[model samples]
Target: MKCRDGQMIPKEQRCDGIVNCADGFDETVAACAELRCQSEQFQCEYGGCVDGQAQCNGTIECIDGSDEKVELCGRRILVRPTTEPPTTAVPRCELPKQPLNGSYSVVSETNTTQTDYVLSYTCDPGFKLVGHSTVLCIEGTWPDKMPRCVQTCQLMKHPSIVYECTEEETEKPRQCNVEEIDGTIVKTSCRKPNYYSPVELPYMHCQQGMWSSGPVCTAECGTLPPESTPLVLRGSTAKFGEVPWHVGIYLKNPKSKKHMQICGGSLISNTIVLSAAHCFWNENTQRLEDVTNYAVAVGKLYRKWYHPDDEPFAQKSDISEIVVPKLYRGVELYYKNDIAIVIASRPFEYKLYVVPVCLDFNEEFSNIQLHNGNRGKAAGFGLTTGMRGSESPVLRVINLPYENYESCLNLTSPALSRYITYDDKICAGSLDGEALCRGDSGGGLAFPSSISGQRRFYLRGIASTSPPTNDQTVCNTHALTSFTSVIKFEKFIKAYWYP
Candidate 1:
């Protein structure tokens, strides 16, 4: 070979990854490359080519420093041939292969008649695969490692899992087993409330030569729900399941835990009650009340309904937990987020009077223009005579129109107007004087959700504060009642409420 500087050398030095000339022309790719690079050979910088196996294998086989450059090396996994003898006593260290059984078969991957083609491998019906499935043929010799089919554990009698160390405990263990190889997955489930799972789905995985710790099912308070329509109440009277998502909150009378004081809640899911945060606030103490001292009644219109009705009457669930968001400074005269989740110890049985109601998430029915003079309906246990907090035992439905925005904006209290947000507070009109009463707090303001053909009543807002000025004789029909719109804080409700 002749160098660019007019020096000459033997032809063998051309592709040897060495600089033999002043200008390094003797090791140039064009002069070094014997022919078009093959699968077993690697193309280097400046058109140079060398044995691909030598590329990034610690030794620089390319004259241009391209062999082991960091860009091409990645994590530098030096996958030595599985057939190499182990360098240590560590079980995973590899060793050369022994003579294979003649019965095992292999075929040329490229052509049936070609002896220099790749070898493909597979095992019989019941065998574990190890190493690459294909090995390459180079210069009449296989340079890559050959794959093997090892026997798996055939544990007819075993526990929920087995590891390499306890393989002997299995009734039908693997034969000639390697020291510590990951085992196959075992199928089973943990009984009762306890659950076994790896990826949500239950499956005992024997990973890294042994059974790994998997996810366990623990008791949680709530789970959210999906799309559906519960029964809607008729003009005024609530039938069984009609307005099923509606719930009546009752605190154990301070004097007696057996007696209950009525409040209101909306059932968003199986075991969750969406209610007003003020329901748990003890005004006397100026603090939140203990959660364990409350109960929720579903599927009933009358707080103390005793007679049989055509629909499912009442299913009472003990309040196990209550979560009120921290956004509100405390229970204020103006109900802000005033929202809370009441977790029931037992799921309310879905019946005529008990069902779930879909929240006005995303304001999906915004096109309905509920705020633009649209009249919304509310089915609550109060206000036939327009009393402040007094509620009749029977549920009553009343249509309240959308009030002028200027009304909530013109409230005498600056704090009320300042805290009343466009999305959060909705001013419903009682132009002829049919506004909500104090007992209606937490009751839902539902409008017809005509999105899908179904007549689903989607809760738009929760009865927060109706300005308590209306009592029997002083009923102001033209007053606008303020409510916390459900669409505004549905996300915050879901995040803090749902388990």
Candidate 2:
């Protein structure tokens, strides 16, 4: 072959199956590229040309001749077999394929009974577990959605109070276990003297399953009583309101007959009497006297029915000690600290009719409010709307309503308009004086007849004062009459005066 430059013609200078140009410019240099055939100009010394294409196709004709310069090769490219190794088959021992962005694995392999494989699963961050941790993987796809491990429950320290099972040790702390259903376990127990309402007794439950959120442990603050238990009064039930007030003379009475005397009082306890404190005091000296003159004439439905008709009206004995807090100084006909405990001369023969009312020491009126709100009943033998000295011949029970404190403060001007502040006092009456009679003072306000019901009056506020000298009806005015909330003095009363 001659050079492209056509300068030399010697046969020895020709490309003779060897590369002589720096760039392998000879076309016959690839002549031994294993073309399997020996043409006179080009032939292979080993394997055949890849794809049956001639190794040198008007370009460099050897395996290494692929390095030829483009000027000599003229855009010609010689083909060759690729040298990459083949891929190996996948092994069966490896874990099943996971999704692109999550983690999953075959928890249990398929068996003859089930063609399904149980898959264990976990999720990326910020996700919560919603479904089962193990799911069936059938025919290369999961049978159900995979579960995720995530943060859900309100992270909590130990609970403030916890409930224990009937046989469980009291000393041990309560724990919240995982629920069978999908939800977080929260809440624990009830504190003493405060039992859960029966409906609320099964204290522990899942938030999402039962409640919309966390389990709120409802703790009680007062005496824990049985379900539907009423403070049963044991004596005769009087007429609608038939207890009479008898004004009689007692031995050792004031010789001058000028002494203020309260002939009848309610038996709050065997030892205590619910009477007007101002009735026994001297207006000038402000001194209380003659504790023994007091007597509780219970069951006196009518004044003249003392013997056969009324069964002698069960005469209870006289008092032992007259204990009235000295702080109770007469402020006005409107008595303050009007409450006095007459240590009963003897333990009361606890008859159903002579039951002691439960007292409200904390002033907390309700644990849960009823939808219609709480309407209470008040019974007394005092005056009516207009009659001054005309007291009811029989005790009368009237329905009364309680008013909010802040709203009552807005009426009759701020200085004169007052809200009930005595810890032992509670207030009742609508903005309009639509309820309560003149003789309702010094009576007990009962509460929460049942756990399921609104807090009924057992012993709440003591009737303290009437509203300021304003004509506005108790219902229409912004302020109304208030009673003393007894809860403030619960400890004081229970400690010193409770028999």
Candidate 3:
């Protein structure tokens, strides 16, 4: 049936093709008309769709318009084509972020492509950026973003002083301060004491009015403890105190009963003993082998002749060689080069009662001459009292002054005066009275220092001689002694140490 608009809605029937009217009448006549439809239509029977056969059933040609005139069916109409446009996708972007405080840079990314961006950080005037200055964008987001630059810290105050003040120019990589002292202005280089390749600005201020000076400058290695002390073999048993004495022996003619005098000696090494060169320099009768006649004793606080205990401190060894400088003039006790070396035939094995002292080479000689000079200890079995006295049983310990060389030379022969020089020799005791006496020649003088956390002593000088005095006066007064300075002979000792 046709609607009020005259548009026919086809009836729900099994038709081979689309029909123009509701009844199957449009399809039956269209099949008989034998008209072919286009590719747009659905193929069906009884729809004027002749298809490939192009044969009409036994009916009038209504689809060909022949049915419109003959069968009186409505004419076929064409459907119109509608026109509309395609839709487009929307565009989007991710938000950018800021770095944290003290930060200089931040990063951002686009969501669609995930592209990264990095930015640098900057601070305002009077402020500083102290943290990481840059960051990278990752996963559509920036890591370490929103950085804030902060203010710089105030510089540390300089020490107060009236002297010209220097400015600190450079700062350490990890540190931010400079050193200042009050006093006179001391101009110091930018070099840091303990750091290598230290950075600098230019100048630093000394707070005080005066500049610092002297040997006070420290080494690059920093402050070190005191020098090693000379080791004493029997140091443990002996009471701790000062003993300034020396050992000596008598020289007698083997053929004639006549007696001659020479300086005695002391042991300071395993195979070395110290003495004066003048004692053996020109003396034709004396030989290095004569060392067997001498001995060393410790423990006796005072001089005593013929003490029974002297043997305990006494150790005797043969002298292998006598080393004296070739320039040495035998006539005078060459005060400066007055020292000699005695090589023992065998090394002295230390026992609990005997010890050796360390020698100080770099020590200050002037210091040893001042307050600490008379403050030394001496050990030997020299005569306790009187000429021609017997040996003491206990080691004779005495306290002696380290005297000036000028005064010591006055006591000796006039010819010997010029031989003594401060560089090689040191003087001790009274020229006209008792001093390092007759039997104390060739002994070691020691100075001690606390080094390596232990009590130690250093062999400082060697006993050389009894200052030359009139034979009658020498007997009337106690003998004054002199020694060769070990500090001066440091090179000489180390040279022949092995040989």
Candidate 4:
């Protein structure tokens, strides 16, 4: 049927709380004034009726052409008998989500019609709102896409301070994954370490994209924790993470394909190590060892064989550079100016298990100078009599008595005597069958640190030579072992490390 304006209308649209004709003519005592319709009959304009097959069957049976109104004539149409909620399939689907920087609410799709939903978003603290204010709920979806409550942070008020999101510059293939609920965090800190802040708080909490609090600027130097001494062990298994300053030097011969423990060293800095020059430079041959396959293993208490389960991660570094004295010359079975500094291939991150030891860079070894009986500890992974030339599984240290300065020079090897001077070498002797042996060369001879109010482990000397074995399968006892005096070469250490 046609309305007064000659507009076509579907026969089923009559009296559907809608007017098919102008001036309320369709629903006013005409059209669909009746509450019901026959099964095969559909009411048309002005109470006219047509067969169901004539409705939207691609043909117009009504005089008003109401049967074929394009929509019903083409697409499958479901006629509603009442206003009761329409039947829909399983509605296991959830609402569309918004960004993490804002909060959202579901005003519709609450176990009701899958159609029509109103989604609204609110920006979090320290953030600004953007995008659409409200989302339209149409067919269980927002016809107008949900607005994003963009995360934003105010510029750092302090001009010298700068920050970047933690997730932004992190290196890939991280060792440990830390899940953060607040998402990517950008931390603001001082631009540089030398700029000098009272507190070195380069780290701060980041919520959303905004700084939760003002960026902190603290100096890194002044905030280091006060030094403390670890418990001294008496020839027992070194506890994991203990004696962290001790190091193992391994050398692999590329030509022979033989890898072996050549010497021991001490960690003095993140990338610097103080060890005997003999580990690399041979004084007798006046030639340097092939260092291409040399590496230092730190953070390991057990030597030679490390238990994978006990210490899963062992930090190893290749020797990138080495410094030896210009005047140094090789002595038969030993060398002079025996000290050297080693630079690591990669930067080291010092932790509890891998820490640098204190050094005698300022002639600070007063305890050794005070008495001839000062018992210094000499530790290494060298061979013991029980092992019969094999490297010790655990680090072995002996309480070696400091020999008198004058007596040390006279009693040491006749060959080293010409090279040894008053202040260049440190001498200590062991009474028992315990002494730093072949693999112990370049190891640190640790003494009680003498920094007032602090008792940190300090390297007294670096091992150079040991007496040959006598009456025992290992190094002989009651013989003086000479070491490269750390104090004698303090100028070299300070020049390179502190400078």
- List TM-score per model, in order: 0.49, 0.42, 0.41, 0.54
Top TM-score hit = 4
The sequence of per-residue lDDT tens digits that candidate 2 reaches over residues 175-197 is: 44332222433445444332233
* Whole-model lDDT values for every prediction: 0.57, 0.42, 0.44, 0.60
Q: State the lDDT of candidate 3 residue by residue for 1-499, as single tens digits.
A: 4422255654442233333543233443312235456675333322344233222233322232222232332443332212221264223323444432333433322121112344567665535554445533333444443455543333333221111243344332223323332321233332222112223323333333222331112111111123312324321122322332233433545575433334455445556656777666544543333544433332233333234554565444445577777666554334347667767666654433334445556766436543424545555544444355644443445455566665566655675455556677666655334455555566666654554544455566777655444554333234446567787777888876531
Tens digits of lDDT, candidate 4, 136-167:
44333343445665555444444345655554
lDDT for model 3 comes to: 0.44
* lDDT, model 3, position 380: 55
Error of 3 at 490 (Å): 1.2
RMSD, model 3, all Cα superposed?
A: 30.7
Worst 10 residues of 1 by lDDT: 218-227
